[model samples]
Target: MAANRIRVAKDKAELVKSLVASKDTTGPFQTYVEVMVFAAALGVKNKKRVPLGETTKREPSPIPQENFASLGYDLIIKLLGINETKDINILSSREEQDEDKRTQIFEEYANAGLEILQNELRGSVDYSERILLFLSLERDGYPSEKQEFDLRSFL
Candidate 1:
């Protein structure tokens, strides 16, 4: 089955060009609608594939772990891969909508590093203030670089 497959327009660059070059829509909905219409006119149904399951290697794979640690904000954001939005929303959800989720994310970040900021962080303060306060605490209190990074995990 794999041997019979004819690979056309390989890679994202070709895919994007193909999308742009073809615009055969009728209504106010422009690009995407036109694309769909073109496919429908040609009696082309969407291509289905066997599910990749737990081990599908998607394109544009993650950067090396060593590289991830160097990027700004990547350490915290990437490492915190997939948490529910409820837990990490001090800035967005100040209305007490989902403080528990935000708190849980905070605690998780704290745990990943050594700072363990759950106890020290004030509930009343906002995200920006917490960041500044955390930095100050890390610089003054923690004499080691590792400790500083740990506290910064939250910031």
Candidate 2:
């Protein structure tokens, strides 16, 4: 049986570790799952997908599905698959191939996102501030309602 753990591309392992808060590093997120989820979302937002290469090193380590599943990230996986195939039946099958497809989508997006983040964060010592600024810029770049009532608009 194949292992069911979610993977971080070997090349992006250090980036992942540096983004998560830990005793060794005071990153913005509290856990690896949080960082990866955010990365996956970023990838989805930017419409980028990058396949994993040389993942055998697994520096930050592969995450068990339960970690994200417990936090409801599995829905994001399923949603990505459905979006990619435009078939809701992708969600109904319990076959290993279907599961692998979802996992592949997630990993590719996360890998692409990590690459984007790495470039954006290069030479920056404060990831939290940089990330907030990056997010603000991204928000500003998007067209939205002129009278939108978002509370974040005030901040």
Candidate 3:
């Protein structure tokens, strides 16, 4: 059975479009799929899952499930769903309803992630640099000085 298309938040559609690299633009990602998946990953990392609000009228066009499946991203998506529910049974269910539920979960995360990206990318002239800094912070956290250990107080 064919899976349903993945939808992005309506309010974030413009942000999504602006993030993609096109002849007229110089965004980091190559395609919308990449942008969406990256945003989803960000959502997962930030533990920010939000239900999708009003969607555009086929604007930006919902991506086909096959696009992700073709690139083996479906597994990553499924793993995220399983992780969220803390139930491996989510992997067993193949019903359309189950698929839709999983899709909803993914979309919600993407929506939240997009909101984060918008806030982080705002006022940045270079998206790549801003994104790299964001990733660095997410990975290593803010730099801080280490306190020296002193045992003389115990004496």
Q: Against the true structure, whose lDDT is highest?
A: 2
Cα RMSD to native, each candidate? 23.8, 6.0, 5.5
TM-score for predicted model 2 compared with the true structure: 0.86
In model 2, how large is the Cα lDDT of residue 101?
A: 80
Candidate order, TM-score descending: 2, 3, 1
**Backbone clash tally for model 3?**
0
Residue 118 accuracy (lDDT) in model 1: 27
Worst 10 residues of 3 by lDDT: 1-10
- Scanning candidate 1 in windows of ten residues, the lowest lDDT window is 1-10
lDDT of each: 0.30, 0.84, 0.83
Q: Per-residue lDDT tens digits of candidate 3, residues 90-135?
A: 6766667677668888888888899999999999888878999999
Model 3 score (lDDT):
0.83
Per-model TM-score versus the true fold: 0.20, 0.86, 0.85
- In Å, residue 73's CA in model 1 sits off its true spot by 8.9
Candidate 1 lDDT over residue span 1-155, tens digit each: 11111111112212212333335312222232232223222221112112112221232221232332343322333223234343434334344334333333322332222112223333623433554576587568856666444666678
Against the true structure, whose TM-score is highest? 2
